[model samples]
Target chain A: MHQAIAILDSGVGGLTVAKEVMRQLPQEEIVYFGDTGRAPYGPRAPDEVLKFTEQIVEYLLQFQPKMIVIACNTATAIALKHVRSQVNIPVVGVIQPGSRAAIKATKTGMIGVIGTENTVTSGAYPRALQELNPDTSVVSLACPALVPLVEKRLYRSDMARTVVSQSLQPLLNSPIDCLILGCTHYPFLAQMIAETVGPRVSIISSADETAREISTLLHHRGQLETSGKVPVHRFFCSGDPETFQAIALEWLGEQIKVSPVFWQMTRLSR
Target chain B: MHQAIAILDSGVGGLTVAKEVMRQLPQEEIVYFGDTGRAPYGPRAPDEVLKFTEQIVEYLLQFQPKMIVIACNTATAIALKHVRSQVNIPVVGVIQPGSRAAIKATKTGMIGVIGTENTVTSGAYPRALQELNPDTSVVSLACPALVPLVEKRLYRSDMARTVVSQSLQPLLNSPIDCLILGCTHYPFLAQMIAETVGPRVSIISSADETAREISTLLHHRGQLETSGKVPVHRFFCSGDPETFQAIALEWLGEQIKVSPVFWQMTRLSR
Candidate 1:
């Protein structure tokens, strides 16, 4: 499709997913929105997370995107089905793709999931994994401390490792051969997590699988972009542009301009 | 560059590298040659490996490639420097890229390497890792049995896990935070390896890093192909095309035509 693929997260965490999309589908343009102002939607109620997601999706509709990717686990957990019903185009959420990847990776049917409190409490991953294979045994942990560590840029610190170590003890005690990084923010702490968990567990991220799914869906629909033109990606954040740009550059491995996006309730009325 | 990037391996194992190159650089044409007739260069003499790598390099030169990648770890260990001196084009090898990735992934400064006998014996990974960081400790294992399993298409059986478990016992006993799948074929057995080693150890494969290095080199040299057309990849094997093509299709995730390449002794006379 000539139209861009729109993706949004609560904050810069979704850049992990965006980075994979760019690497796997270089020809397709991306319109990304990060609601950093009201980020860490992890602590919010489902109704508020859904409302925020709707606002961003509404804002993203101006790009005339062919697909929408709910890149944040919390947003995907609470808002995915609601947004899918509201949108005319394909709307993909992170949980299903992550669950599918874990299913494919695990030799044992036991899987561990760690995400924000909202995502874990909602039981999204366990439901998704069990639905895919009823025999799958899932251990879910709510890592409420991680998102703040990542957002504060303290992921590499000793304190972060201590937090990760303490949080993963229950799952580590289990027989999980695969662990899903349920939050988009969690991948930033992958090294620490892997170190704490040891060598036996395969860490599964939704970014690569989500990108592959998008490519497959686009190809099946004959909407795969075939033009030779270089794709220009646009980034927007409802918070400090400089902060967003810095994190985006660090995570995506490229320097790109970030523009500020303010929500206008009147725009939705139109 | 308009010309293709040439890659050669002792056998079908290098298809892993070829697969990554295709995924990451879709617009760049590839000329791949698999020296399957004299396959399993792992146990061969260093001088013999050098001679064979030179012959393949000479053969690939006829394609007018802009860069050459020594996709086999054994060939890289024995002949990379010699091959680089002989060719004017940039030559990339698997060992350095894989070592760099391992160094980046390891948290304990303890790394493990699993490869063919020649690769492990060459002490290439230890040298590379130590050169990058002197404090880094490396545990090298020669998993000579694994390549045969992959080549024989027996990688998915229970026997494969048994083989992997037996092979990785020493590394599992160590404090390694990362394990390098030094041979390209090793990635095919990654699931089993991960299960044997457990979840704490990160698996590092050179394919993705090698592709990135190729991209960086091409970009730096102003040789990156910016054409929007789908690049066609050519495959040649010095042995049975049917066997190589089946493995290539399975490993590369695409249907491709494999051409038989006979070693003409008289061609070297020119």
Candidate 2:
């Protein structure tokens, strides 16, 4: 029973980060929470998102997690600092890791970001990127249309490609060599995004980069699991457990137990 | 004045890291030390490498650097922990960063490592890889020939291509999807190395990855330089200043001022 990394996301969008964490650090146990009942926190107001994130963190504290990852882009942009102030443990957000990665990957000094309405409006990507390298030119697009499609499990549909193409048209004209998938949900549509963006621009999955940084932070803290034991992952979602279970299975590419889970998360109300 | 990242290597190998730091964090200043007189610490005794690395750190401490990067793999394998005990600031080593990157990139779980004699013999890569993931399969090959070519600036010669092919012959057959350029110098021959190993393997440059982690560490510590002023980098070499300057200019692809230097490093005598 290793002290797990507690990861909280608005919905299955963060399944991308969880999948990478599972692949990259196989021995570490994961306790993931997806607030699918309030799925697509992107278009929501900042204070509401922050309150919801705080509720999830409070719920996860019962596990005595060694670290907390705000895996949802919208949630990370809104509540990362607030969450860090609340917890004594290491709190990692999806923003800075993606920003650092884009800074590493970009050759043109111009970078592109596509996220939710809340994330883009918060101006987190530009602030994060420029904070690391002030000279970086950031072009941000709010893909408010994409996350709902993912939450609804329509990311594989032809409509996803259509929405993705139409939404990305403004950015294709820019001279960015590296595009940071500012939203975690975007990696689910990565293939369609890549084909639309062409071969020159590199597509950076913030979720994957965040997973790599989690390994870095854990390594520096000397908390990396050295055990040979296979980890049994636990997942909790606030919405339809069946829909969550279906999404988790398809995205994580494995059997993830998400049953016997009551959606009583509203009890931790503000 | 922004505190600089102090980088030390056994000749120009760590220039790969320094170059990346400059490129990725353009605003951050760098203080680089190249112990060219004691070049190729690869085949040296671990005690000797450790002693030499300590001497460089002692000399670098005069500048009050915020971070000390043991950019040389051989020296890092010998001295990272010991140096961390001596310095209050963060001490970064190249090995773990590369190991983490390889883990992230490797789909087959079979990873390859190519480094100098000391780094290979230290079993650092395997330990680092397995520490993060107990299931990772690591195959390490010590390419003692690559570093010397880089030291002599012969990395571009036809000899380099032939030597790279001959040296990497044992690894080509391994079912590895990612090859960690374990030695900082190996990136100099990365082109030939990549060609010889074919496109099946993703080349993981520890030097570049180490620079990326340096940013992550600084960001977490809230020490990333925010001033818009351009950074003036300093270079010092214990051996011939002229040869060191020549290699610096070529490797860094920028004008590096290395002059008015007396080779009195023996003053930090044991």
Candidate 3:
């Protein structure tokens, strides 16, 4: 029997990471939980995120997820430490995998990080970058509007380009060889960001790196799912199941069997 | 020659209508334009929504659509008159068909219209209802968060239910035999809204009625493209093209090809 991995995020941004894990770990049955109701965790407070994360983990544990991947940077930064202490299973956050990838990719030692305002304020990426490579210089900017923009399905247009340029104006002056898309949603806007920031700056996606990290950790810990014939990936959103499934099929390039699940808080209230 | 119909919206909600149109008219081609960059027109100022509508219509005219559908209620209310005066093609807004359907469905002649804040604020549905049946009572409520909540993909969660409940609280007191889902996005939340509003209220969807209207109009005008082997439906989003294509396939429910196009401001840019 193959072990199941539970991946949770505030919303669809984590799907990027989950898809990558599916590609790398073929045998594991992946369960995804997206908190679409209070998504874009960047602006949210730490305690709120911690509580949300706990609820998701507990929900996923009912299915016996062998490991829990906090696929969101904002939640991982604030909640992972506390979550690790409580859960018996292994927990992984995107910051370290992304930080390692950025440290390795940058030749100029100067990297640019674009994330939500709260994620930048958290100083999570900068700290991880510095810890990995002390001499590395990081220029971080919070794109306050980008997440909402992307969430609304706006990634093309002069307006989208204008917003991208405006958000990235400060980072342009720095000589950075690599740009880290600190938010998972940032990758969807990679084309506009790349055009504005110039092609020389390599765009690093945390989704890819985090997926790789999950596989390596599972292998080392002897928790890897080694058997399964055609694993099924189930996606549950606290939002529109159709839209989530649609975007997942597009992003994952697979006919994902997505079904609607009702999160009955009233039942839990009893 | 099969004439192409121009379907425009502030964003992806219109795709629901467009998908229906494609299903109903197989031989006819559709040119869908979503102003994804600055979407959720329902909450936007009437003037801004008007400007957006005009811009998209002007852009779509280059494709020479036989008719244009203002798939957005906010845009339809604000700009339908202006668009009709300027364009030679027949203009259809989701409002009239939906209002007509609600009026016909209601036994007590009390109709409730639920849509975005701007749509309800503009009194579009009320005006449409009164124009069709002067004696009918109209109750309108602004569902400000529903569009964004749906756009973010949170349709089936406790949070979604809570939001739906709160938004519909205003309508619960009013006696309505028929409830009109005035926005295209509203249909995605139909099941939940119906469950909350109870089984007594007959839920009216604008998309289905709008599709029927287009069929009738095209048939009367001799623009119906019948006897073709298969109809081609082309979807273009000012966002992630691949993502749009995937969601379209799921919504479209048939093996139809979806292609991407750049929303260029100028001819030279394209």
Candidate 4:
């Protein structure tokens, strides 16, 4: 049996990454764990987010994935290093790929980033961008209200436009030519974001870049699936399975059955 | 053993479709045959194109594919129904999906289509658009020169820009809000095409839509790969393996090994 790629996130936001992984590396089986029960890790403390991420990674380890993808921006900002140290297999995060894309996409060396408050405050994007190109100018904003709208499935609603417009007003004033949808959930609001920023600004989503990185890594490691077989993707949500399934189907453009993953604080040791 | 999705085209043009299928359904093994030796089916007689398509289909049938995708526009325009009649498995074409995407994308109902001389002359897109939405006004241009440029790997060259500018000059004059890269190879010149048409026109490529259609068909038929394994993709070319391999790697974003598929005129009867 080929080892699967394990991906974990705070909630359904990670589904964006999973969708891209499915698109770019369709042959690799995926074992996805979305900690939807205690989701919206955006507002949570770093220690709490790190703890939850570790717990989910430990849970996913049972399937013996060859690599791990931290699909959530908040969790990645807080827990990527900790998770990497804890896991024996390769672990990837959304930040580096996203930052790299912004750095490459920006013609003016002026880039803007939008994410949850925690991720923005963490300054991951700015740090990554500056490290990549020292002369780059990074402007980041925290759209704290956007995730809840997404969770409530109001991404296509008029209210989403208003929210996106108001949130992006500051960034629009900046001279940035590229806007990074720093949070995975922000991709759902991409249309409104695009409309608000107009065509001049390129919206960079980490999903595609992240998927490419995973593919390149798998190939170089000789872990890419080369057999003639279709991969079975497994989804586990610590929250409502039905809700997760619906969103997964919508985002993936296919019918998918999602299973519930029950966890408790006491089960952390196991 | 899992069955592969069989895709055939006149030449490397189908690599665009193959690339999308890999991105959208990465887990499913693909058996791709490019009839490159006798390619540029665009200018060939319909009967000759049909006969070549049938022979490729017959050769691919040996792989026991679960479905067939006619990735070439000329083949799709002329031989889709014939191919479907010959094969028992699910068969998909690029024209309908591309037409549907154009319909969905166009706000002004004024659409532009660019393809080889055969596809444009066949009136496939115009007919498809009219059949779906009579209100749609379709403008098509026969880009007879573009394919050879692609075959010779001049897609990103200054010559490509000049060629694209010349071909698109008529369409740009029209009120077309959306332009369809009707030929599979046209996607290679997408940047040049987009530059010629400017940012107002949405460039529609059938690759993603075709991949989605295949996914939907496979899922509905309960044929989606649910196994936790990696799929190995096979490539066959009735032309130069080295040339095909170079293009495949560049287009697919991975290093792929290509095998030669020799054909004889006498074997048509068998």
Using DockQ as the measure, name the better of candidate 1 and candidate 2. Answer: 2
Best first by lDDT, ranked: 2, 1, 4, 3
Query: What TM-score did chain B of candidate 4 earn?
Result: 0.96
Writing each residue's lDDT as its tens digit, candidate 4 over A1-270 gives 589999888888888888777654556789998887777989998988888888888888899889999999999999988887887888888997777657555678898899999999999889766654556789989999899887777888989889889988887778989999998888888889999999999998876667756764564355877554677899888788888888887888988878886654346424
Ordered from best to worst TM-score, the candidate numbers read: 2, 4, 1, 3
Candidate 3: regions farther than 4 A off: A156-159, A264-270, B1-270
| Residue pair clashes in candidate 3 | A239-B153, A239-B154, A239-B155, A240-B153, A240-B154, A240-B155
Q: What would the DockQ be for model 2?
A: 0.78
Pull out the clashing pairs in model 4. Answer: A23-B23, A26-B26, A26-B27, A27-B26, A27-B27, A227-B232, A232-B227
Which CAPRI level is candidate 1? incorrect
Candidate 3 lDDT by residue in tens digits, B1-270 = 666898988767787788666544545688897666566787677887887788788878988889999898888888988998998888888887787667656778899999888888888888766644456799988888888776655665679888998889988878999899999888778888998899999999887667656755564355766544454656665555554555555556655454444544343123
> Second chain TM-score per prediction?
0.96, 0.97, 0.92, 0.96
How many clashing pairs per prediction, in order?
A: 15, 0, 6, 7
Leading candidate by DockQ: 2
> Residue B207 error for model 2, in Å?
0.6
Query: What would the TM-scores of all predictions be?
Result: 0.53, 0.97, 0.48, 0.55
The DockQ of predicted model 3 stands at: 0.01
Candidate 2 regions off by >4 Å?
A: A259-263, A268-270, B259-263, B268-270
Model 1 chain B: ten consecutive residues of lowest lDDT: B261-270
Q: Which regions of candidate 4 fall more than 4 Å away from where they truly are? A: A1-270, B264-270
